[model samples]
Target chain A: MSFINYSSREINCKIVYYGPGLCGKTTNLQYVYRKTNPDQKGKLISLATETERTLFFDFLPLALGDIKGFKVRFHLYTVPGQVFYAASRKLILKGVDGVVFVADSQIERMEANMESLDDLKINLAEQGYDLDKLPYTVQFNKRDLPNVAPVENMNKLLNPRNIPCFEAVAVTGPGVFETLKNVAKQVLVELKKHY
Target chain B: MSGSDLVMYEEEFGKIDEELQRLYIQTNAKVVFLVDKNGQLIASAGETHDIDTTSLASLTAGNIAATGGIARLLGEKEFTILFHEGEKDNIHISLIGQRIILVVIFDSRSSLGLVRLRVKKVSEALTRIFNDIAAKSEREKSEGKIDESPFAEISDEDIDNLFR
Candidate 1:
């Protein structure tokens, strides 16, 4: 859901980064937080377990430059990617305006990616959001790893609909901003339809 | 993300802001803010000038989300209220109207009982206002009164300009 506060002249949207465990969802958010100017960003809160793994979710509020005088803010969130955290994932997707699926680009994690994608579909359906209709993108993350699967193969499996897809090395920040910008654009376009 | 849009006009915003201001004075809390289930800050009052309500709203929503998940696992429909006691300050979070979360932060000058008492009453009032706002938005949509031209006026160039 996009929040348009005419009183404050502000537009707020919720974008959730979702994928299997260790797919670099949180890393994508951390990179965005580090790169964003302090004045344009807020505190990044990670509700992680003792081992630094996300327990519930990681949230980062970012203020983009105004769009035609209305301040545009995107609240970025990452759900716990572990399979056991299915409940948490559903909760995080409650009012999401957009989604970025960070698929692990490794041969071993391909099955995890598929499971997580199925999980995403099921969860979104429960929330009355069709995965096919939502403003969504895919980032084949961990591209720097030598043992990663080919982009063509991953794309075929993860992105059958052929939505915007990017190769990302989230830790080193490659394709991170591109991914964020494209997702944010899609979200705004979606908002335009309703506004 | 569900297919729902949160529309807030100046009129409803004023009503909500006024209620929050009342709650702040009635409870003497450090700050009181309303956050949507999606983490958007709807309104805030009290001593929030120096605080980052944006971050506060996001974190509070996440907190409520986690707590709500716990409630579900325990076979509960939802956990309506959560109170976090800190050394210097405390936080009271109430999930009202199932779509809004009311958060109150205060220090030792106020007791939990008083804050909870005040919050219970305020939550009901807020719930009513939000209900009316939702209804009005739906009516606008049905009547084709929503101004969608602004969205049409937004070009790709305009979107690209923001990143640059």
Candidate 2:
């Protein structure tokens, strides 16, 4: 859910990065955190296990430019993608304004990617949100891996709805900004409807 | 947790801010804030100069959400109150209408009993105010007063300018 505070002239929206474990969901947020200037970003907090696997979530608050004189702030979050963290995943999806499904593009991880996608739909439905109607996009990450699936194959599997798709090597920051821009744009447009 | 975005108008904000100020003073709390279940900072008051209210709001919501999840697993409908104690400060969080959370951060000077007592009374007032705001927004939507063109002036180029 986006919070439009007319008194503060600030609009805050939450965007979630979702995918299977090791699909570069956290990497995407780190790239954005590193690139964002100090003034435009808040502290990045990661709740993770001892070995660095995400335990609950990773949160980053970023300020985008003004839209019609109102400062636009986006709270970027990443859900723990391990199947055992299903409950934490559901909590992260609550009140999400937009989602970037970062599918693992490695050939061997396709099933995991599909399972995560199904989980996303189920969690969203449990919260009364329809995946078909929510602002969504897909990112085929790990594109630099040698055994990655072809874009066409990944598209056919994940983007049957043909939502904007980007090939991202998130660790190197390629396609990260593009994916973020699209999701933020869609969120802003969605907010316009309620304005 | 609903899919709809939260729109706080000037009128609604004024009322909430006033109440937060009153609550802060009445209970001698160091800080008090209201947050949506989604972790959005709605309104806040008191000794927040050194606080990162935004981050606090987000983490508090997560904390409450995790608590709620545990409640469901135990077959409870909800756990409406939570308290975290520290050496210098303590936080009390309670649900208002199960949609918004009220958090009171107090130091050693104030007792938890006082904070909870004040919050119980104020929560009733907040619930009514929120209900009225929701009703007003719904009525406006049906009357076609909800304009969609406020964002027409924002272009894709404007958005791109942020990353650059």
Candidate 3:
């Protein structure tokens, strides 16, 4: 859901990053925060458990330039990747306008990724959002790792619907903004119809 | 804005932030933030950056929202305070004005009574600020000029830079 501020001529949409634990969701956000100009981004918030694992979520508000007469603002959020944090994940998904599913590109974590993807679909369905209809994308992260799953294989398994999947090495910032820009574009396009 | 709608007494929020800072220090809490029940950050004190305040504000707001839903189901008009004691830290979530939430995070050293005492007074001040905020937004939506911006003509390059 977007809050269109006619006074400021700004359109604010919330985009959530949904993925399994440690699939570089936070890293992607941290990369964006580091690369963004000071004036255009807000503080990055990470709520981690005692071991520094993301317990709830990490949120970053981004001003994604203006389109037509509206200043486009995207609130990026990442759900805790751990499976037991399903309730927190659902809460974060509320009012989300778009999503970027960051999949861990390792063969060992394939099942976790699949489970998380299933959970994502189920939660989105509960909220009246059909994943196929929503502005959504996928990022196969940690591509640089040696034991990572082959891009072709991962895409075959995850991107069967062919929804803009990117190969990302989030720690090094590769493919991060590409993933974000594509999502932002799709979200804004979705908003254009309503305005 | 109408007289009731425009609370001229709203500028007292800065003073409240200072008071919150004092409470944050006295309680030895690492971070203390105030946000509307809608999840907009009002003011913050103590380690705002060292920890993830953006996520904290939203999560704190989410906590209140979920519990508020439960409260509504139970036929309660409001939910006052909720405490979650974790392994190494604790979060104290309190609802204010049915429109704002006050959250304080502390280590093992802080007590529930101390955080609540501060939230009780802070919420009173914050409630006034949020009401004024709501009033101002309503007024702007009615009075401000609404039109498309020239940035709608932004070049593809400019749009590309935004994601970077």
Candidate 4:
């Protein structure tokens, strides 16, 4: 969902980066936080365990400039991807306007990717959102890894819907901005259609 | 936009601001703000210049969500209020209409009891205002009176310009 403050002339949208454990969801956020201008970004808050694994979520607020007179702001969030953190994941999905599923591309993590996607769909449904109707995308992360699956195979297995998918190494920031921009555009287009 | 999306117009914004201003003054608060459950800063009052309210809004929502989750585990509906005390300043957080958060930051000049008493009245006023806002939004939406989006004429190039 998006919040349009007519009095303030601003629009706010929430986007969630989701994937399995250690799939570089946080890495993607860290890369964006590092690259974005200070005026364009807010503090990156990570509620993680003592070992540095995300326990609740990581939030980063980015100002994506103005569309016409309304200043557009996107609040980016990443859920804790560990399987047992199902409750936390559901909480973070509330009022989400867009999603980026950061799938790990290593061959051994295929099952994890599949499960995480299924989890996303189910959680969205529970919250009365149809993933098919939202501005959603997929990213095949960790492309730099040696044992990665073929892009075509990953696509066939993961992205049957073929909604814009990118191959990315989130740590070094190859396709991070591309993925972010695609989803942000889709969100803006959706806003145009709605109003 | 869906029914759940928040649309704040000038009329209700003024009303909310008045209530927040009253709360800030009555409670002697350093700052008082309202944030949606989605972490959007709806409105704020008092001394906000030294604070990063954008970050504060996000973290406050996250705090509520985490606590709400804990509430579910214990078979509770939701935790309606949360308070934190520090050496010098204190924070009093409560849910308004189950969709918005009311946060009050104060120092030793005010006591917890006084803050709570004033918050109770302010919360009631804020909830009524939000209900009215929701009804107005729904009426406008159904009657096709909602303003046309500024992005109606947006192009791919226009979007790309933001990245630049």
- Measured against the true two-chain complex, the DockQ scores of the candidates, in the order shown, are 0.70, 0.63, 0.14, 0.70
Per lDDT, the best of the predicted structures is: 4
Docking class of 1: medium
* lDDT tens digits, residue span A161-189, model 4: 98899999999999999999999989888
In candidate 4, what fraction of native interface contacts survive? 0.71
- Which candidate's TM-score is highest? 4
For model 4, the DockQ equals 0.70
Please give the C-alpha DockQ score of model 2: 0.63
Q: Against the true structure, candidate 2 has what lDDT?
A: 0.90
Tell me each candidate's TM-score: 0.96, 0.96, 0.66, 0.97
In model 4, state the lDDT of residue A23.
Answer: 98
Candidate 2's residue-wise lDDT over A1-195, tens digit each?
A: 788787889889899999999899999999999999899999899999998999999999999778778898999999999999999999999989999999999999999999999999999999889988888989999889899999999999988988899999999999999999889888877776666
Model 1 chain A: which ten-residue window has the lowest total lDDT? A186-195
Among all windows of 10 consecutive residues in model 2 chain A, the one with the lowest summed lDDT is A186-195
TM-score of chain A in every predicted structure: 0.99, 0.99, 0.97, 0.99
Order the candidates by DockQ, highest first — what do you get?
1, 4, 2, 3
* Model 3 lDDT tens row, A1-195: 655544445666778999999898999999999999998888888888888788877888887676665667788989999988877788787777789999999899999899999999999998778899888999999999989999888988888998799999999999999999888877766654433
Q: Least lDDT summed over 10 consecutive residues: which range in candidate 3 chain B?
A: B1-10
Which candidate order results from sorting by lDDT in descending order? 4, 2, 1, 3
Residue pairs that clash (backbone atoms under 3 angstroms), model 4: none
User: How is the predicted docking of candidate 4 categorized under the CAPRI scheme?
Assistant: medium
